[model samples]
Target: MNNDFKNNAIRGPINAFMFKVLSGYMDRLFGKSKRQLFRNHPETVVEIGSGTGANMRYLKPGTTLIAIEPNIHMHANLKKSADKYGINLEIKAIKGELIDLADNSCDFVVSTLVLCTVKSPEQCVKQIKRILKPSGTFIFIEHVKAQKNSILRWIQNIMHKPWHWFFEGCHTNRDTKQVLELAGFSSLKLVSYNLYSPFIPIVSQIRGRAIK
Candidate 1:
């Protein structure tokens, strides 16, 4: 693991509790999208940068689920959470840019609130594409840069520096939608949107399926 992945969490108890609360909300929300995207069809679903397995419940047990999480600190929680559900969790301390999974092996690929912090977003998407089988859906729920009221962009840019420093690669202003297109993800169907993040005017909730 790298130094960035081994950094200690300085999050306060209150902050930690809030993180869990928000995460639980995402799990519950994504469940519907995940179910609708697959229509209850069981398939191999792999999630890149699965932080602490917070979204595990959204995945069906019959679906083959695998995860790649480079952060060692998050893996502890990932394991604990996986055990709680008796889920088959294959976690690795490997970067999303450097995933080591077989190409075209997964029926679907997933990501959640992860792209904002990954080092090589393009490479990660390319790797994800390679691993997904034909017509494999890439389910995701991420906060993206806003289009209206340049106010969001201004705020994001102003707070970007300290944000990245403290959060280890997080960029509040990452143009996630553009990046996804650049990575060749054209099959997109946005499901929802939100405007409240720790510090951002526009946060997006999206659903996209890769056209393999």
Candidate 2:
């Protein structure tokens, strides 16, 4: 296997375990928000970093779902999840930074817990803007850097390197909300929230939509 596959192989189980451990709380916190957004009922949707197809249940039937994910090991689980959820799925083995779709081809672009992990959050948002139709919506839920000068913030800064290595490039301190605003979306609305983490308050998150 190649280096990329080797890396994915090593990280995939960890990711799976992490998700399993966190999924209950994650679903509880964000499940209603996801359902409400998908109720808008966009026909063509593109989801970035669709790990294990966790968002599949939020989509409406007959919706065309374009799933962009690069990790080979996640594909089987993702496919199974898609099938179980009855999603009209189209899988793309690609990264967010290098989306291979035509401009203005998507009605809705979605990302869940993924912005912090992309190679370039700026580039990924740019591609999201590029692929979205003029009136399309971009929906996202992302972890972000905590309040400046706080103890948790300091911990996030100190732990950034090891966290990146262990989590396969997921940055614990990304200001993802700022990145979305600076990406030049026509209208942006984001709300900062927190997940229930036992150890630290650094699990600061933002979720909302931007119109292109």
Best by lDDT: 2
Alpha-carbon lDDT, every model: 0.66, 0.80
Candidate 2 displacement at residue 67 in angstroms: 0.5
lDDT of 1 by residue, 1-212 (tens): 23363344653233334445577665555566655665554556688876667766666664456878766556666777777766688876687877788887777777877777787677778888888777767766666765556776677777788776665567677777777777765476655466454445335445555565
Off by over 4 Å in 2: 1-7, 199-202
lDDT of 2 by residue, 65-123 (tens): 88887776667777787778778888888878889999998888999878888878899
Candidate 1 local distance difference test against the native: 0.66
> What overall lDDT, based on C-alpha atoms, would model 2 receive against the true structure?
0.80
After superposing candidate 1 on the true structure, give the runs of residues whose Cα lies further than 4 Å from its correct spot: 1-22, 25-43, 197-205
Clashing residue pairs, candidate 2?
Answer: none
